[model samples]
Every structure is written in C-alpha cells, then in structure tokens.
Target chain A: MTIASITGIGWVTPMSMGCGRDYKTLTAEAGKLPKLTSRMIFGERLPRFGRLDGYSKLGFAATGFALKDAHLDQWVEKRPIGVIASTVYGCLATDIDYYETVVPEGGAFASPNLFAYTLPNVFLGEVAIHFGLTGAAFVINEPELSGIAGLRMALNNLILEECSIMLAGFCDAGRPESFQYPVEVTPGAVFFVLEKTPGDETLSYGDLDMDIEGTIFFKGAQVQNLQNLMQRCIAVQSI
Target chain B: MEIRRAEIKKVCIVDTAVVTALGNTLQDTWKRLIKGDSGIGPIKRFPVGTYDSRIAATVDDLRPIQDRSIIYDLIGRLLAGLKDIPQDTALITATTKLGIDNLENIRRKKAARAGDVLPSSMPEMVSGKLGLKKAGINVSASCASSTIAIAQGSAMIASGQADAVLVCCADIVTEFTFSGFSSLKIVSPVPCRPFDKERSGLTLGDGAAALFLMSDERAIQEGRKCMATIKGWGIANDAFHITSPAQDGSGLASAIEMALVRGGLQHEHISAISAHGTGTMYNDLMELTAFNKVFCGRKLPVYSVKGATGHTVGASGGIEVALATETLAAQTVPPTAGFQNPEEGAEGMISSKPVYLKGDYLLTTNSGFGGINAAILLERGTNL
Candidate 1:
C-alpha cells in the first residue's frame, strides 16, 4: 500500500474554475463551459493561451490553478515535479479537426499546429514547460477509474521516490462532432497536488491511500472516481 | 495506520514476444536484424501522391481482423506466442494512437468499431484476450509510450506492488499518422538513415511487442527462465518544447544519470546503448548530444534499429527491449541498417557493423514528442 497527502485540489468544469471549488455547486450546474481566458489562469498572462486547443486550455488551466493553490507558483530552478493524467477520448476531437484539413487539400493543408496536439500527452507537455517540471510526465487511458488511476500512478511514483511531489488528475473533452462513437462525458479537468509528506502552513485535503491491488481510499472510504474523491474532500473540509 | 514503503524486489523479464514489419515473430526479426536487412518499402496502404513522404514499413499481407482495427490482428499474433501468463498479472498497454484507422473509417462513412477509437478500448481488448480479472491502464505518451510503460511495470514489480506485469504495445502506420508526420515535414521520403550525415527524417511502421515481467521469487516459483533483469529505470522530461527536443540534451542526460544512480551502478559499467534514433535531424542529434554528456565524451558503442524496422512509434521501445535481450544473449550489437557516414556527434558512437558486447549491462533510452524521456538498464539473465 501507498499513502500520500492531498495538499491541493484544482478543477475546471462548466460551472466552476480554480482550486477549492465547491463540489456541490459544480455538480448542480449543467451547462456548457465558458470560453477560458488567460485572466482565469491565476493572473499569469500566457501568450499562447489563445492558440491552445480546447482540451489543452482546460487541462492547462486546472494545473496552473493546482500549483498556485499549493503555493508553488514561483520557481527558482527547475523542480522535480511530475504530472500524470487520465483521459478516455483523448485528443480525438483535435485529431478529427486536423484530419479534416488534410482531406480537402490532399494533405497539403494539414495544419501543423493542430497536428502537434493530436496526442493526449501534448497537454502534459504544455503543463510541464509552463511550470518547469522536469520530472516524469505521461497520460493514461482507463475505461473505469479514469481519474483514480492517474492518482494511483502518481502515488506509486512518489513511493518509489521518483519525485518528491506529483500532480495527478483527469482531463477529457466531449466527443468530436464528426466522431461516430457515442461516448458519454463532460468536458472538464480535475487535478490534485500530491506530496510525499504534508508540509507546514499548507492545507491538506486528507490522506489518500492505495492498496497493493490498486484499490484507492480517501478518509477510510472507498472512492471509485475523481468526482467521488472530490465530494469526499468537500465533505471533510466542511466538517 | 502505519506508514510503510514497498520492499525493494528484483524484477526479471521472463518472456518477450514481437510482431513487426520485418517478421511476425521475435526470432525471425532478430535473424533479419543481424543480417542487416531493411523492411521499409513503398507505402501501399494509402495514396501518397499529395504527401511529402511516400514510403513506410508495413506488415506484409496483413488484414484487419473482423473488419475492426489492424491492432487486433497484431495483438492476436503477439499473444499467440505466449504460453502461460499469470492470472493475477496486471496489464499496462502503451500506444499513441489505438486503432486510429477506425476513426478514419468512421469519418469516411464506412463501417468501424466505434469503441476502438477510444484509447481505453486497447486495454479492454487485451484484458478480454488475457482473461485478466484486474483492470488495465493504457499509456499514451507519443513515441516513448512503451519505454515508459516497461519502466513503470518494472517499478511496480521492484516495489512489491505486483508480482507479474504484462506490458504490451502496438501502433500501425495509418494515413492519419502518415499525414500528420508529413505535415510536420519530418517524414523521410526515402527510408530513414540513422546517425548518417545525410539523414533526413523518420519513417513510420507497424509493429507490436509484449514483455512479461515478474518478480524474481515469482519467476522462480513458476520455473520461468529469466531472459533479462531490469536493474534500474528512470524517466524525465525536457520541459522545453512540446514537439522539439532540447538542443543541449540536458533532459535525456539527466534521465541516464538517474538510471545509473538508481541501479547503484557506475557509468563505466554500461557496455553499449540502444538509441531511439528516429533519423529525424533533431531527434538523432539530441540523442547523440545526450550520449556524449552521459558517457563523458567516451566513444561508447551505440546502434539503432529504426533503419531496419522504420520508426515503430510506441512499439519501438518494447521491440528494442526484446532486441536488447538478444544482444545480451548473443553478446553482439547488430549493425545500424541504412547507416553509412556518421553525423558529427555520432562519429565514434554509432556503427554500421555489428559490435561484440564486452559487458553484461546495456542501456536503452527513448525520447518523445511530449519532451518525455525514459531509460532502462538491463543486466544479462543468469541462464543466458
């Protein structure tokens, strides 16, 4: 089993954006997410923010908020912080968009900018470059436990001492317009800052635990997905 | 509650299987590799009149199983070679694009398996085939997918989290991928020339590889022969560019240093290296620069198989690991196909002729589009 302290939480949904958001309010809202702007990213102006695809924008915003909430916004040198994220229909929407340009011009019009974001891991790279995180970063896709799996991998990296801190979460976008598959999902992102030990002065959401079998628990209760863990964090914080 | 760290355990590669454009089995591929054969040819899978690159390495006479994705056929062929897999073994698949051709079909208003379009479907398909009760996860880092997956699985076993782990990865050269690389202006019109001064770019390929890793105690209990032992593994990111590598090669150098540190081994302990060597100007240059820094300007033996198999994307690392085991067993490093003249940084490192191994340890490294870099150090198995 492995244990880590959830020092910070950041999420972006249709209803709310930023760290320490109310889970109930987010669950209550049922509408399309507003267009994310650079101003929403903790007052830091990102010149490339407008150029990012929707999926990258959502993930980048959540991670930016996560680091800021954890009081790690400034970097004197490159930090050994890692990021692992889970997705189901990762970059498929961008892929279709990129391919559309290829079909018309017989590959001559294929957008290089769009092709760069075809893989799901590209967003993780954006986060890493912006934060100067030189630790291990990758993306995982799981049908079930989509969010929890990323957390598990992050905790494993922490336990192995691969890095002292890790940012784990899930990021997904709605199905592409031309995609024939029917995948039920909301376009959003959620991230948690996990540290090997709880530091002084920083508020910890709770102790997160995972068994050898990869089963996860938060506050002694089994959690299936990131939403469940978020609700648990909100419930515990309220008390 | 008590805080406990996982006990460090020894992890061994009990078995490996591979199916690539060169051959359908690891033995066949190894035989062709040592003979210095090239599998890259004209791209007949799709029309390339409008594309910059017209050739790629493809599995000959391959048809999609049940009109689904070629991935199924590749995985089936790969899984057929394995005899016994532990029931409790967890699975971790690696692929940048899982059955992406299915999406192309769907877009063209043709019949397709919609579920296969999702990356998660890969693990589902593998779990069903393996009859594994535990769920699986799919890693989707670009070119470095399988390398990271292998390292992750080894860490799981070494940390006592899993006794056995099945790491499988596959990626096919589809029009979607071909066009993407072409648009990026990195696909070589002719076959790739790794480490050559005239090296142009990478050539995509179709392949799949599986590595079954088990803890030393479990492998002994199962009476499985150890093919190789994972001594150390490390992963790092350049954090420089999304698609470009750092010119200084600092990120890759850091990863290599970490691997040596974690293995409790010194730089001199490594005998040779299996480089990523995509043949792209930046990738090959960045790798050579990193090698120079890590080995401290020593002319260590380095070889790449991309010229023979083309760039297999996600399967490149797993396939290279299989070849690494063969290198240890045969005590020889195969020649780099399509290589003649060496680039400036590759003068003393890379060779077009086979080099005999002098030590038991070999280091394999891969870097990808996300600035992701991973290295794994393998020691010769006792039986070998």
Candidate 2:
C-alpha cells in the first residue's frame, strides 16, 4: 500500500516554468524550443554552467528549481533523495560531439569529458553529483512513456520506505536534425517532488495512483498547456 | 486512516532461462559452468586495430534477427511453459545500450540521414510481443540494471501490486562498446581474472537471461516449481565518485545491512555469495572491504562467473542470479574459474574449486557506473 502525494511541482518546457520563484509563462505560441545559453541558465554567471552539456544543463537547472521549491536547501546535501528521470532521446547531441572527436584520427585522441556523456547513465550521474543525492537513481529511456515509467520506479522505492521524499521528472532534448538517428523527441523537462504523505509537514497537492491492476497510474500527470500557472505569472490573460 | 499492506508476501522465483556464449538452455549453461569453461576468444566480425583488448566472450549462435526480435526471441524461450500470465504480470526489460550498435551505422551514412535508432521504450515492445497486458517498464543503470529490475519485480509481488513479474536482460558486445572501455583502460587484453592478484581488468560479454517471479501462493496454485525465493533486496549509492567506488565500502555495506534487515536474516545465515567481482582493482578492493564489514570475520565462500560470461554489463546480474539459483538447487558452488591467488582480506574467501553450499541463503550483489549498488537475497526452495 503505497500512497505518493505530490508536494511540489517544477516543470520547465519551452513554453513556461512552473513552481519556481520567477515563474515565466509564455503566450499560446510558447510550445517551440527556447534558445538556451549559459547566461540564461544561471544568471549573472561568469562561468556557472560551462562544463555542463546542454542536455544536462536543462535537467540540472530544472531540478534545481524543483529542489528549491520543495524547500530542501538544508536537506539537499544531507538527505539521500531518490531520483528517477525519464528521457526519450538521451545524450544524442553529446554522443555526436564525442564520436566526432574519436573518429577523425582512428584513436589518436580521446576526450574524457566527451566520453563521460556518451552513455545515458552519465546524465543521472551528473544530476546526482550536482545535488549530492546518494539514493537509488535510475535514468529510464522509454520512447513516449518514459515519464510514466520514471514515476512508477520512484513510487515503488518511496513506498518501500527507502526514502520519504523523492524527485521524479522528465527531461528530453532534441537531437541535431541533420544527424541521422532514431526516433523523434521534443526538448523539455517536467519535475515533481513526491513526498510520502502523513509523515512530513509539507502540504499535499493530491494523491498519485499506485494500484496498477488496470489503467496507467501516472496517466493524470501530463498537461497540454501551462494555462493556469501562465495566467498568474504573465500579464496576458489569453493564455 | 492510511493505506497499508495486509501482510508481507513471499516472492518466489518460479523459472529462469539463459542464452550465453556456451549454450542456449539454462541446464547446459550450468553444466559447462560447473566444469569451469570459458567461451572468450578473438572476435571475428571486426578488427581490434590498436585497441587495448583483443578478445571478448560472445554468444556466436545468435544470428542477426529483426530490430527488437532478439529480445523477443529470448523472452519467448523464457515463457515457454507458462500458459497463463494472468494479464496482470509486470514486464521489465534491463539493458545498458539496447541498440547502440546502430549509432555506427548512422555515422557511416554521413550523419545526414535518419535512422532506425534503438527504441528507448523497449519494455513496451517486449510486453507487446509476449502478449502481456498489465504493466511494462525499462530499467537502465549501467551494470546494475538487471539486479535493480529483479529487485523491483520481487518487491512488486511482495507489496501485492502484481501477482507475477518477468525480468528480461540482454546486451550486445559491439566495437562501439569495446572502444569505450578501451579508452577507459579497463578492458583486460586476455580473459578476465576476478579477484586474482594478477588480474588486470574485465572482458565484455553478450548474453540474455530472464527470471519469472510470482508469489508463493501463485506458484503453488499453478503447480510450478519454486527454484528459489526472493527474501530481501537493497539499493544504495556511494555518492563518492562518478565512476570509482568508495575506499571504505561504506556505501555497499549500507545496502547489505538493509537487505539483511528486510529479509529478516543475518550474515551468519548466508551460505554463499555471488559477487560483482568486475576484475578491476578498485571494484575488487571495494567489494572485499564491504564483504569483510558485513560478514564480520566470517570467511564465506565467494565465487564469480565473469571468467566464463565476461561481465555481460546489464545482463550480468540476471545471468549471475540464474547461476546462483542453480547453485542453490544443486547444493554446490562452482569454482571462481579465474581465481588463483586471492587478495588480502579476501583470503580463503575465494573458492578456486567446487565447494558445497554452506547454508540455506545466498546473497547476490551488483555495482554500476553512477555509484549505484544493488543486492537481492535468495533463499533455497525446499518445495521444488
């Protein structure tokens, strides 16, 4: 009997940001990808997010907002928070850049940094290192249903009492169109802070479905638009 | 009012099968393992060029099938006898890189064309092929992927979420796979020597293993044989380094302690141990330290099959567990094939020859790249 309550929501897509301090909601034309630079990721930064890849930068920044929204500043470095992240196309861009470095001279040079992100598990490692999360971490790649899978893994761990609070989210980034590769994936990340209810003092949003006998439990997690939150953040009521 | 489980359920391992470099059936694989045979040799499909490693353990019998048909074929063999999966069974697929070999093909085409890249959601595909209707998901966490997936499967049954669960694990050894480890300098030029003083590093292997799990009641009702029982499981992170493990082995020890607590068993009850034993310096040292801490001066017999299977990556855990279940049933432990001289703090623990099972319980563990570690406790089944 596992009951996962949504305590905090932190979503960052091309359209808007939810559960952040300066929440930004765009108009109806906000579904396109945002041009993200290092400056836009960490403001007033001389060299904040330089070492991080674009794929990891989006995930890392979105997770930061989720963690901060959960008020886990004191607990971030101390407690072991389990993280289950979902991705459709993971590390595609980074793999391209890494392989390009390897093929030119037939093993003449190998960049260890580029080699790090070649595998998808490295993305989970980067996020775990950034947040000091030592709990069980799984980076699942399920075509269209990765977000739902991530939620189930997180809920299973939390219900088993491994961790009271867990961070489950979806992080997807587009690959270079010129490159010939796999399936299609849009660029975005949506993170939710799931807390085991009745133990912690945080207010709950609602209960998440855990009985998996029939329908998909995480089916209610998606939203077509950030219309409600957009109205509060932006001056435009047409959202 | 709160939601609570009525009672803790016993997770039972009903059946298991494997396809490795040696044989296709589980019995055949176990027989060859007991005789201490290694299938590692030079790969003929490609060239090594100037790489650090020259050979790998590969399953040569598997012909190239369709895109996802390899998994489908292996899983079909796993579900051979079972008539009813009850439409509520959980299907889990574990792999490090499902179809990473395709990346090279895309590159050869000038990187300007589209591709039939590996589907990230392979579990759904597997479930569809098997005609399973309830739930499906994929788990990818480096080498520990299948162990974690197996543990999750057992927990789903133990927690009353599902009546049955099937875990399928497979990974192919490719040039792209070889180059990465070669770049890291972790691939041994010769066959791997796990826990030996002269051990250099690991050799990669390609294989697939599947474990069908259900509750004890379901196993009894269906008149199925209970090969083993999943008593406990644990998962933890070192948080020390991205690739390297902690020197003190605290992270792994914590997980061992948790599994013991969960299974309601002590270290003294453990008869045999199936170790990760990746043949690397740090991995071997860290595992020895953790074993010493958990066993507390008890030199339990330890063995690793990597000498024969050659670290199948994500598939390694499932293969190891299948072998462990065989050991539990046979009441004998196979020799650590590549072990000759043992490392310090691991003296007398490495069984260089066939040894009898000491007790009724066995512990299997795996550690992976992201500082991730996982373990599952299996109890010998008497009802089989």
Interface Cα RMSD for all candidates?
Answer: 2.2, 3.0
Q: In angstroms, give how far residue B51 of model 2 lies from its true place.
A: 0.4
Which DockQ values do the candidates obtain, in the order shown? 0.65, 0.42
Q: Lowest summed-lDDT stretch of 10 residues in model 1 chain B?
A: B1-10
**What are the lDDT scores of the predictions, listed in order?**
0.86, 0.73
On a 0 to 1 DockQ scale, where is model 2? Answer: 0.42
Interface root mean square deviation for model 2, in Å? 3.0
Report the C-alpha lDDT of model 1 over A1-239, residue by residue, as the tens digit. 33788877888888788886334333645567778998767585778788889999888888888887777767878888999988887788898888898788678878989999999999888888888999999999978535877787888888788888999998887767666666677778888888887664347888878777667788778878887777677676667
lDDT of 2 by residue, B57-108 (tens): 8776554354433334444554563345556678887887665555655666
lDDT of model 1 at residue A153?
A: 81
Model 2 regions lying over 4 Å from their true place: A21-49, A75-77, A105-111, A175-183, A197-203, A207-209, A212-239, B1-6, B66-87, B110-116, B119-121
Which pairs of residues have clashing backbones in candidate 2? A143-B121, A180-B113
True contacts kept of each: 0.71, 0.41
